[model samples]
Target: MELVSGLFLSKRIVYKNGTPVPLSVITKSFEELFNIKLGDCYKKHESVISRKPTKLTEFLDELRKFIIEERENKGYR
Candidate 1:
């Protein structure tokens, strides 16, 4: 997923999580993987918001295609 304006740019399916995951741990993992200090992802940003539904739907479709391809390669689908 892309990081736009210091926020994860994705279409969140679950609006709220009953078992909340630790965001700090996630960000730390991302920072380590990307080799970049995502300090902004840690802070609050009022300006950052989700993309439009049309664009988000496109992204979701692309992601679904990728997942299908991977599963097919593994002979699972």
Candidate 2:
């Protein structure tokens, strides 16, 4: 949820015409793809923003770490 919210907020994911996608649309697509309901995506994003110790991008950071670890494990620079 946090990852999706971050992407939505950044506007990095867009339509072919370069229009910013709506948050609800992105969230709905994610829900359908993941087969799980994310209730009140806006509220969840607010909670992520209000995280303690200024770790707002916790999930994104974790994802980066996982990708780096995977690359290292595969002997790829």
Candidate 3:
């Protein structure tokens, strides 16, 4: 029997005030804020409907924290 799986993929990103915020960042933020994680989705590199993730959720939290930490560590102001 074929097992069911998922593939989650998304476009580059969404903009707010013309800021090129990566989609991953936005998703990461949501995943952190509400502790929300989704499972696998059927996604492929080329194809609109072929966007999905294998795991519904991610273990990473504190999306903002991570961003801050990265900036600070790099001494980017």
Task: Give me the candidate number with maximum lDDT.
Answer: 2
Give the alpha carbon lDDT tens digit for every residue of 1-77 in model 2.
Answer: 77888889899989999999988889899999999999898888788878985687777789899999999999998
Candidate 3 lDDT over 1-77, as tens digits, reads 00111112233344666555544455455557778663322231133233345432222325557888999999998
* Order of models, best TM-score first: 2, 1, 3
- Clashes, model 3: 23
Distance (Å) between predicted and true CA of 52, model 3?
12
Instruction: Give the alpha-carbon lDDT of every model.
Output: 0.52, 0.88, 0.41
lDDT of 1 by residue, 21-68 (tens): 344555666779989776755352222335565654454578789999
TM-score of 1: 0.41
Runs in model 3 deviating more than 4 A are 1-17, 39-48, 51-77
Q: Which residue runs of candidate 1 sit more than 4 Å off their true CA positions?
A: 1-19, 42-49, 57-61, 73-76
Q: TM-scores, in order shown?
A: 0.41, 0.82, 0.28
**In model 1, what are the clashing residue pairs, if there are any?**
none
**TM-score comparison, 2 vs 3, better candidate:** 2
TM-score of 2: 0.82
lDDT of 3 at 71: 100
In candidate 2, which residue ranges exceed 4 Å CA deviation? none
